[model samples]
Target: MVAIRIEFDDDEQYERLKKLKKHRGLTWKGLLLEGEKRVLEQTPE
Candidate 1:
């Protein structure tokens, strides 16, 4: 129910993420959500 915009510092940063997305065979949403899951799991509330 919300829209989020992601900004990369440079092309290299974006390219690095693109590579991970390709290697994981994940859509952009899946990749971002996976990262969010990891952060939540590692951090205490």
Candidate 2:
């Protein structure tokens, strides 16, 4: 598995992701994986 790192310059964006993880009942890692899946599903192979 590959690891990805993302940095946010704005506190609001970071807070939003944290809120989303809480709302979706997922950890940060899980939230990233969920986002990856969603993006990949929409991408053309």
Candidate 3:
């Protein structure tokens, strides 16, 4: 298992992510894992 640390240096970026988190009804971990899945799906192996 791997752990990731997310640091937002921009206020807008952090707020946007928080808003999306609420809109999608996800906790911090869920938000990150879901985002990871999205990127993985778009990436070519």
Give the better candidate number (2 or 3) by lDDT: 3
Give RMSD to native, each candidate. Answer: 1.4, 2.3, 2.2
Model 1 quality (TM-score): 0.83
What residue pairs clash in candidate 1, if any at all? none
Backbone Cα, N, C clashes tallied per candidate = 0, 0, 0
Model 2 Cα lDDT, one tens digit per residue, 1-45:
977788997999999988999999998899988989999999999
Q: What is the lDDT of residue 9 in candidate 1?
A: 100
The predicted structure with the larger TM-score, 1 or 3, is 1
Residue 4 of model 3, lDDT score: 77
- Local error of candidate 1 at residue 40 (angstroms): 0.8
Model 1: weakest 10-residue lDDT segment is 1-10
User: Using lDDT as the measure, which candidate wins?
Assistant: 1
After superposing candidate 1 on the true structure, give the runs of residues whose Cα lies further than 4 Å from its correct spot: 1-3
Candidate 2 regions exceeding 4 Å error are 1-5
- Worst lDDT run of 10 residues, candidate 3, spans 1-10
Off by over 4 Å in 3: 1-5
What are the clashing pairs of model 3? Answer: none
